[model samples]
Target: MNTTKLAGNFLLPISLLIFSLTAFSCSADLEDKVVGNWQGYDFLFQKTEGPDIVVTINGGLEQHLRSKLILSDNGTFQKLVGEYDNGKGTWVVEEDKLITTNENGEKLIYTLLKVTDKELMTLHEVDLKTPDGTLKGKIILSYTR
Candidate 1:
């Protein structure tokens, strides 16, 4: 076997391994940016050709119902929607999606649309009951610390 060819073959695998490790470390660091207290900044549930669902921020009932999410580096989370709707869950990031599995084995998947040091926006789709019928719509949630 040619010596150069042998060295080239070994170098490719070593370079790939190093790249994979670096990517994984960077992903962990990105996840760390999500660890902290996050308050609801925007919540829009819009239906096709219709007005958006309202989330009042002026200390009304809907404002009081807004949830605060706390993410921990240990992959655990607490979401307090209201006095009666506190939830605990485990979360993981797969690619750009955030998957949260609650204690009851229900999983909610959110596509991470944006993430910054102070803001995180996620898109979720779900079947919702409308006046006409049931249909799938998007829920855009924005959070800030």
Candidate 2:
């Protein structure tokens, strides 16, 4: 067997293993940063055809109605966005996205803008249907520990 060919074959697997390990480490780092209790304080709703609304929940009764998200190390989460959107389910971080699957098998994907020991910011676009028409907008949920 040619020595160069033998060395090349071994190098490929080793390189791939190193790459996989590095990626897993980075993913675990993100998972660690997000595993905590977070309180939603800023809810920004930007609509495509209407006025954008911003709701800032201060330290009062408003805080009681704001979003609360709990991300666990066991790959589960509970999310309550405002007074309506509430569910408990499993969650995973894929690249820059935080994906959650609720008990009803509904998937909510949030694009993660930032995540730190104290803050997690995410944006999710939604289409709401009403008797008038379909309203398209994006919701930015900002949470703090």
Candidate 3:
């Protein structure tokens, strides 16, 4: 067995192990691109319940509360509406989805549409139970950094 050939064979596995460890630390939880401060841009509410008619419902309960949305690298988030505040929650990116769990234990799953260094837009499907009945719809929140 040639000594140089044996040494070279051991080097390949060692080099791959080092590369894999570095890659793992760099992408821990996959939240790198979304950890930043975002400003509220615009929002749209759509009701997707009816058979033929699609109506835009208005009012508030996750309304267009506009201001600052801060997504920390530590996996926590805060949304400020005006000065009083809107809500605070923990957020994580699961594949292409942004999952947020509010303080009230309400979990809202949002489909990550477009996330960039400048803008972040998400679509959230929600079911609200009121005195009348259940309202099924989706909300799109657009934000810019």
**Whose TM-score is greatest here?**
2
Question: Total clashes, candidate 2?
Answer: 0
Tell me the lDDT of candidate 2: 0.67
RMSD per prediction, one decimal?
A: 15.5, 15.7, 17.2
For 1-145, candidate 1 gives per-residue lDDT tens digits of 3432343355445434533543443446658777888888775443433323332212223552377888898999898875445788899887766888999989999866666789877667667555655645555677888
**Top lDDT hit:** 2
Which residue pairs collide, candidate 3?
none
User: lDDT scores for all predictions?
Assistant: 0.64, 0.67, 0.65
Superior candidate under TM-score, 1 versus 2: 2
lDDT of 3 by residue, 1-145 (tens): 4332343455446434533443342223446877899887766555545321223243432345457888998889987876767789898887666888989988878766556678777767767766556766666677898
Q: Which order, best to worst by lDDT? A: 2, 3, 1
Give the per-residue Cα lDDT of candidate 1 at 117. Answer: 88
Clash total of candidate 1 = 0
Error of 1 at 22 (Å): 18
TM-score of 3: 0.66
Runs of candidate 2 with Cα error greater than 4 angstroms are 1-25, 49-65, 81-85
Tens-digit lDDT string for candidate 2 (35-134) = 9889977654445543222222122225533768999999999877665656899999887678999999999998776677888777677776555566
